[model samples]
Target chain A: MSSVVIVGAGLGGLRAAEALRANGFTGTITVVGDEVHLPYNRPPLSKEALAGGVDVPGLEFRRKASIEDVDWRLGSAAVSSDLAERTVTLADGTTLAFDGLVVASGIRPRRLPIPGPQEGRHVLRTAADAHAVRDRLRPGTHVLIMGAGFIGCETAATARALGAEVAIVAIDEQPMVRPLGAELGAGMRRRHEEHGVRFHLGHSIDSFVGDDHVQVAVLSDGTELPADVVIEAVGSVANVEWLAGNDLDLSDGLLTDSAMQVATSSAPVVAVGDIARHPNALFGSVARRIEHWNMPTETGRRAGATLAALLAGDEPDRGPFCAMPSFWSDQYHHKLQSFGMPGIADRIELVEGSVDGPCIVEYHDASGLVGVVGVDRTQELAPYRKQLAARAG
Target chain B: MTVKVFVDMDKCQHYGQCCFEASDVFELDEDGKLQYVAEADESRRDDIESAADVCPMQAISVE
Candidate 1:
């Protein structure tokens, strides 16, 4: 029987495995990952989970009642992979050979690199990290957040909801300015400040102080604020170190074609999730690598099918996996939904709804109508999904 | 037979919805990262395709 080996047991990896099975492949399939826990939902990590309202199991996409049959090599890290030999070598010195190889290894959180930074310093990428931050969220505790991105905002909302005094230190003039652009980003900043989160904008972090209690956060502007707890939601880096010596075209990530096939070497390999940087025909030939939740899950499934076809001696004929990039965050009592791709929004207009009630913000690139950001209004963003898809076609 | 599959790990958040849809190909490791068979038999294409259709990032690209 043929064997298929996958690295990284993330949403993309798991979905790719399931796709192989559903495609009727009766092969020896093996999955390898580095985490010690079963795959759980990450979106809730900053929302309900941090609020102490949901347990880990409740966030699991696969319930215990509906487990799948596969060689689950859990807690094993994939140290290196040979694209030529089609084998994945685990950290334990075991190697799994495969007829096909999929690199679904996701990203790792980027932490603050500074002196005296140790435990108690946190990043909210996983469930455990969220729990740690939640434990520190006692009423009246002072919380200092680094970065004013989506994660930082969500963390601030969670902390405020738990009655913690929250402060955000961002390098950007406005929160989400890079992603949502300046105008809409300013609106998001106002929303947070209105809810009582202190903001120190356009400043860089100097260092985190204290040996045990994390008492001070020093900024480049020479401002030191007393902080009871500090959470770093700065950003993330692609986990592509394994391909350092390999011939793969590793720009910011694994360079791939629209079909998600790695555009390097004669060996057949594909990359997905945050580790992939591929071109999208929809956005002025822009290459994108999105770290959101849903994108990888869908990509993994599609890649699995494409791989199945290649193995069957059939020509892979799948089109570019293009879906309007969308993400939502549950912060405080607000449900913020961002639809389409806002990476290149040159202008944002308040077309419908209101910031006082349900609101929608449409972003137009030079080509018109590229993205939309909605507040307390998911339905308003639904219609644009089809429109975006049509634009891609 | 050899097949090529692509996964954008940056887009994948380790959620395990794909495992339920195509167990033969996808599984969750103990660490909770999603793992999958890199290749599959030709007959299982439809199911794997469906799994990809459901991915949130459109992270999967097949050739």
Candidate 2:
């Protein structure tokens, strides 16, 4: 009987496993993971879970009742891969052979290189990270958050919701300026201000001051703000160090074709989720890497189904996966959803609704066929998604 | 019998809701990467189809 060995039990890996079973593969499957707990969701870690409204059990993808059958090798990490031998080497000195392999090792949150006082600083990346931050959220606690990215904004919202005074200091002209562009970010800035979240735009943190009891946040311009806690949400780095000597494309992640196959024709390993970067046909050779919750499931499903067909000696007819990229942020009472990439929007054209209520904002690029961005209008996003798919062809 | 399934790693972020829809094949590693048992038996077709259906990105395709 043919056996499949998978590495990294993250969202991508789990989806592949489920896809394979759904596709009707009966071979023995072994899942090796580095985390002690089973595969869970991460989006909630920054929202409801961080706000103290939801618990870990409620956020788990696999409940206790459904974890039967299949071999789950928890707390195991894959250290190396051999393309010629078709083997995966784990950190515990075990070798596992595979007819097919899927590499789903995701990225880890970036941190400050120099170690400062580790008392109040927090970075929300996993369930453990969220739980730690939750413990620090007390009434009247002034929190200082670095970076105006999605996680940072969500943390600010969560902190404010917890009745803690929150202040965001970012280096950009506005929060989310890079990803969401300046105009939309201006809207977000106003939204945050309305919620009582203070913003120090176009500034960097000079240093952390004082010992508890509302420390001061020294800014680049010599301005000082008082805070009891600090949260950092700069960004993340892909876990591709293991493939250094292996000769795989590792610019941002393991480079693969649309099929998610790593290396050239000489090698045939599957790469999925955050650790895989490839030129998106829809985005025109953008070579993007998606680190959201929805992307992994789609990629894993395709990888799993493709692997099943290949193992069965059938011609795999899987096409390059493309979709309107969408993600949601639950901040205060407003649920912000941004669909498609709005990286090149000259201006944000409010098509329908209002930011005060559920609204839809369209971002138009030079070409003008909706280059990216459909805000708050999920149902209206269907047209743009279709347009992007058609353009991909 | 053969089927069609596609995975665009660039578009996939690796959240495993598909495992719930079809656990016979999808599994995650200790590092949260996606791993799977390909070549599933025919009896499991319904589950695999369900996973492809529920995939948020529609990154999954069945033929």
Evaluate model 2: give its TM-score. 0.80
lDDT (tens digit, per residue) of candidate 1 on A222-330: 9998788889888888887765666877778777777677765545576777787767666667777887676776567567777777677676655766655667666
lDDT of each residue in A1-393, candidate 2, tens digit only: 888887878778887787777777778778888776677777767776787654655554542222245687878788887767778788888888888787788888887642234567778877777887898898898899988998999889888888999899888898777666676678788889998999998888777776543378788898998867888888899987655566677889777767676654433467778887855666666667877666777677677777777778775654666754556665665545555666655766767765445566767677565444434444345455557657667
Docking quality of model 1: it rates as: incorrect
Measured against the native two-chain assembly using Cα atoms, what DockQ does each of the candidate structures obtain, in the order listed?
0.09, 0.06
Q: Pick the candidate with the highest DockQ.
A: 1
What stretches of model 2 exceed 4 Å from their correct place?
A: A62-68, A210-214, A264-267, A344-347, A353-358, A370-376, B1-63
- List per-prediction Cα lDDT, in the order shown: 0.72, 0.70
**Would you estimate the TM-scores of all the predictions?**
0.83, 0.80
Q: State in Å the error of residue A341, model 1.
A: 0.7
